[model samples]
Target: MSKSSVYSWRIDPVLKQDLEQAARTEQTSIAQLLEQIVQDWLYKKSSPDDEEVQQRLHEAASQTFGAFRSRDSKGSEKVRERVRAKLRQKRATQRPD
Candidate 1:
């Protein structure tokens, strides 16, 4: 197991109430919700602008081939294999020439 650090902070009551309500709606604790929001904010703040290139590629591939509509297991397996192969090829092509 990894060690963890604990930090404490304060926020306005109105803001805290809103966050608490959202956390309840999401079925999570206020601490967890705050942690998630902070982490997301920090990630967006720290990430490089060009990181969206890879993100967009991944989203495009997922949107194109992520879901299988087939009920047949064999057909699904074939589709998975084909999509996996295409993804591999695409990744290979994306590598430095």
Candidate 2:
């Protein structure tokens, strides 16, 4: 255990009530809850290059990558043909100038 110093500041009544409720739910004092919250925030702020963060980001990207599908499995191969067909349809719908 380390020596702790007193810190105080004013906050909104509603926010203070919410914090008190959270502390009660966690079975902790408001000061201890605040200390844990501040410690967690500081840990995250200080570890931008942490491996756990990188692994989470990689997992998210891997899950989302190529998740969307077209009716045709070979859609990538037909992009140019699709664009040409759409352009022809648009031109036919337009009045000639």
Candidate 3:
């Protein structure tokens, strides 16, 4: 491991208690647990160009929008139509001078 540096971060008491319990359950120190957690988060955040991340993002966007073939969207058409209708009705009620 590289030389450890002093990086102090403050967390809430309840979360701290939970972390401590998790550390105890894992037979590790709080520092080790936090280090592992932070490392994992860093790995995920920094892997935007990774193949797995790219594939997952593409899959999610495709699932959300792939079926949108017409002028109206597929999944959210009802909500969009309702909002547009409400907006038009509201506009019609306005006084245009």
User: Using TM-score as the measure, which candidate wins?
Assistant: 2
For model 1, how does the per-residue alpha-carbon lDDT over 1-97 read when each residue is reduced to its tens digit?
3529888788899988898899999999987887889989999889866778789888888877756557676885487789999999999999997
What tens digits encode model 3's per-residue C-alpha lDDT throughout 5-49? 898888999999999999999999998999899999999888675
- lDDT of each candidate versus the true structure: 0.84, 0.91, 0.86
lDDT of 2 by residue, 47-76 (tens): 776788889999989987775577999998
Q: Model 1, which residues run further than 4 Å from truth?
A: 1-3, 50-97
Steric clashes per prediction: 0, 0, 0
What value of lDDT does candidate 2 attain over all alpha carbons?
0.91
State how far residue 58 of model 3 sits from its true place (Å): 7.2
Model 2 alpha-carbon miss at residue 64, Å: 24
- List pairs with backbone clashes in candidate 2: none
Instruction: Please say which candidate is ahead in TM-score: 1 or 3.
Output: 3
lDDT of 1 at 12: 98
**Alpha carbon RMSD to native, model 2:** 15.4
